[model samples]
Target: MATYSEEDYLMLSGIQHFAFCRRQWALAHIENQWNDNYLTIAGQNLHHKTDDPYISETRGEKFIVRAMPVHSREYGLTGVCDVVEFKKDNNGTQVFGKSGKYVPIPIEYKHGKEKTNHSDELQLLGEAVCLEEMLFCHIDYGYLYYGKTRHRKKIEFTLALRQELNQTVLEMHSYWQRKYTPRVKPSQKCKSCSLRDICLPELLNRESVNEYIERRLSE
Candidate 1:
């Protein structure tokens, strides 16, 4: 399908989790399972601080919008952007109530520092692509703000990255359609995963931690 209806659109944020671990994504998104570890709680707090739909400000040439809703029908994805800074530019497009044309730059906030994996980049690119579809503009890059290190890192949306994103989203859609959840392949990353206990990689079955506990108690 060239495009998906709004109803078919999947959660755009799930790409990050899917990239980190497909099982993690399936558990949280498909199985409706989740747990709040320190990292997740911290990330939620950071998102809360940054995501306020009512908050919009004009800073000279920059118009800042918090919790901007964005989507891409082509990718069948939807999510809220933490911050979308519209900077005044002659080559940019016009805003609804604003006077001048502006280019949108998306900034994502994470509780932890930069990771060795490309999960963060994949998620950021998903947002950028969604914005491109919504704004009808080309965004060469965006920003990733690390909550732990308190630093902002620039992320370029390269041709290779876009290709990778396309593949990732397609895989996600296929899995979603089948309601498929893959078995866990244990790794060091599991140690810090928020859903580690729920996943119970050691068992590598459909059973959940609570279910296992209850069954053991009866036995």
Candidate 2:
């Protein structure tokens, strides 16, 4: 396993963007350019409500912790989990100042319905893996709470997903190191992309006016 120093750590949240579209990830993460669309704004608002770092609530055997910071040196990633529920269980590891052993299950909050691309699932898996590394415990599953659907979707950290997540992170690091922004690949995803205006996928490879006119006249 390749390990990266803390300085080389990339944002864990970037996995979603990278999984969705490599160009979008490059534009936002490498170039540090971000434009807020409706989806982005809604996600920001939802996170604001769940991101109170100081908030922690106890409900019987479970403790809900908001805005818990997590990182994995092995994976070279860092980010804040929206919610971490420490449930009391005999199989769980002991926590500081806690009465008994507890298992940490991370929950990520996102906007809109579940995407077919599995970007959201990859992000949740990243959080779970980070928590597993930090807590020295095994995490079998996590949760994704969609604002639009108003439901929680359970995600299992299977071997396939983990492998995909790891490969995705490696690719993201390669792009980050070279400061390379990939060219746009036209797809339906471009319609909802916040960076569509910035990317100009259609015009990026456009022909000159003379060439266009010649092609049209020939047709």
Candidate 3:
């Protein structure tokens, strides 16, 4: 496995963006353009609540840790997990300064209801991978908590999913190395994207310069 220097590590949360749209990922992470829409704002607020560094508590056999900073040298990624619960398990590994063996279960909080996309799951898996590297333990699964549903959905860290995550991180690293932002592909999904105005997907899709200018002037 290869290790990344501190400056070369990409954000773990960027898995969601990359999964959603390669162009979107490059635009934000490469071009350094960002504009928050309502959904993004709400999501940030929700994460802020859960990302407090001082929030940690013990409940019976479970110890809850909030805003746990995690990174993976193998994947060249770094980010904070919203919450991580260390559950007591007879077969688990020991945590320093804590009493018994425990397994780490990462939980991520999302603002909206669950969607058909694997973005959330991928992000959660990234955290699990980071935890595994930091703690020297195997994580079988993690959780995604949706604010709208007020529920946490379990996600198994399958071989296929892990492979996909590895591929995604590899792609991200390639793009970062070249500082490349992918060309836009316009679609119905563009309307919901927070960076639509900055991306100008519609303009990029226009076949003629006159048509693009006309559309832009009209808007």
Which 10-residue span in candidate 3 carries the lowest summed lDDT? Answer: 204-213
Q: Which residues of candidate 1, in runs, are more than 4 Å off?
A: 205-219
1 versus 2: better TM-score goes to: 1
Tally clashes: model 1. 0
TM values, all candidates: 0.93, 0.91, 0.91
Stretches of candidate 2 exceeding 4 Å from the true structure: 206-219
Among residues 3 or more apart in sequence or in different chains, the pairs in candidate 2 whose N, CA or C atoms overlap within 3 Å are none
Q: What is the lDDT for 90 in model 3?
A: 80
lDDT of 1 by residue, 106-190 (tens): 9999999999988999999999999888888888889999999999999999999999999999999999999888876799999
Better of 1 and 3 by TM-score: 1
Error of 2 at 159 (Å): 0.9
TM-score of predicted structure 1: 0.93
- Local error of candidate 3 at 70, Å? 0.5
Quote the RMSD, in angstroms, for model 1.
2.2
Best by TM-score: 1
